[model samples]
Target chain A: MTSQLEALRRELDRINEEILKWLNRRAEVVQEIGRLKLKQGINRFDPVREREMLDHLVRINTGPFDDQTIRALFKQIFAASLKLQQKQHEDALLV
Target chain B: MTSQLEALRRELDRINEEILKWLNRRAEVVQEIGRLKLKQGINRFDPVREREMLDHLVRINTGPFDDQTIRALFKQIFAASLKLQQKQHEDALLV
Candidate 1:
């Protein structure tokens, strides 16, 4: 039982590390998207695009998490991504 | 230029899908952790453990997103995971 618990803990740690890597990868891609949007004179916050992404996740989620939970988590991600872009733009303006 | 934009969009989509998968995998592992905790009569929320995880990410992060942004994103993920565990426990109680 202790070994089972230890194995699960290790799995959790492994999954956590993978999630962190993917999240950082996603952030970098979002940064590229932000740069393109800026160059095109488009705003970073696109409600339509955000909605579509959320809908796609909802459709694909086969979960230990329900759709509401999935939506909420991704919304947090989207919010942070927008903040990152906005912060970058603000810094650029000051430069 | 249009092709470049399309390629970036495709990359974003692929990365989003990967992040979603890892996030869900993280959720499942968290669920298992919650189960074991319950079996051991332990609580789900462990601030020290969470802090350790965050510190690990911070130490390793090579970021397009800053540490603050990374922390905020992971905090949201952690919050949602806890909510999932609590909801599941509540549902079990009601059943």
Candidate 2:
């Protein structure tokens, strides 16, 4: 029983590690997009694109997490990513 | 110009999909752990374990995300997963 918990925890930890790496990768891509947008004088936050992405993710979701939960979690990540972009843009302006 | 944005958006979309899948996989593991806890009559939330996980994630993080942001995002995921577990446990009792 204890060993079962150990094994499950290990798997959970592994999954969390993968997620951390992927989230960082996603942030890197967002950073690149932000740089491009700044160069083009385009706004960084694209609500239409975000809505479409969320919709697609919700549609494809098969879960122990319901669609709403999936939407909420991803939305937090998206919001954070946007914040990071805005901070970068601000820092660039100050330079 | 447009092509570059398009390419970046595609990569972002792909990474989002991957993250979505990984989140679900993580949820599945959480469910297993939940079941084990339920069987053992143990409390569902483990603050010490959670603290450990977050600390390890923070230490390993190399990011466009600051450690606080990493903690916040994972905490949200962890909270949601705990809710999922509780809901399952309640449903089990109803059966």
Candidate 3:
């Protein structure tokens, strides 16, 4: 019983670490996109691209959660990413 | 010792429930705002309002985490809310 609990604990820890790593990776990508947008004088908020991304997520969703739930999750992820991009842009202006 | 652990467990559980409830509240407000935005034909992505929210968050931040991290988390929450708005709009359109 102790071994089983330890194994589950270790699995949860591993998953938590992976989530952190992925979030870090996501911020990095957002920063790159920020640079590109700045260079191109493009708006950070691309409605068409966002709509397309949501549609793709729905198409690929093999869910334990429903489509609306997945869409909500992805939307939150994108919003965070947009903020990262905005922050990077502000930092560039300050420099 | 067991009692202390149990108390801590209950506190965490209560925190979890509150977080979920707050999220639901956020979603409800987002829906109301969505209706307003749709009526006005305003873009859902309002940079000025978002910037104000982020600035207010930063001002109030007495942090265990840094400003950027907190901003990122809030940004994710905002993005999720936008997705909910989009879904609701689509449903209205279909009906």
Which candidate wins on lDDT? 2
Cα misplacement distance, residue A26 of candidate 1 (Å): 1.5
Task: Arrange candidates by lDDT, descending.
Answer: 2, 1, 3
| Chain B TM-score of candidate number 1 | 0.95
Native interface contacts retained, candidate 1: 0.79
**Each model's fraction of native contacts:** 0.79, 0.92, 0.00
Highest TM-score model number = 2
Writing each residue's lDDT as its tens digit, candidate 1 over A1-95 gives 47877798788778777877877787777888877877888766879978998999899988877899889888888787788778878887798
Per residue, candidate 2 scores C-alpha lDDT tens digits across A1-95 of: 49999999999999999999999999999999999999999977889999999999999999989999999999999999999999999999999
Error of 1 at B81 (Å): 1.1
* Local accuracy of candidate 3 as per-residue lDDT tens digits, B1-95: 24543453344333333334344455665676667667767676677866776676666555333468757766766676677778889988899
Candidate 2 to truth, TM: 0.97
lDDT of 1 by residue, B3-90 (tens): 7667877887787788788888888888887778777878778899889988988888887778887888888888888888888778
Per-model DockQ against the true two-chain complex = 0.72, 0.92, 0.02
In model 2, which residue pairs have backbone atoms overlapping below 3 Å?
A: none
Cα lDDT of model 3 by residue, A1-95, tens digit: 24543453344333333333344455555566557668767676777867776786566554433467656755765676677677778989999
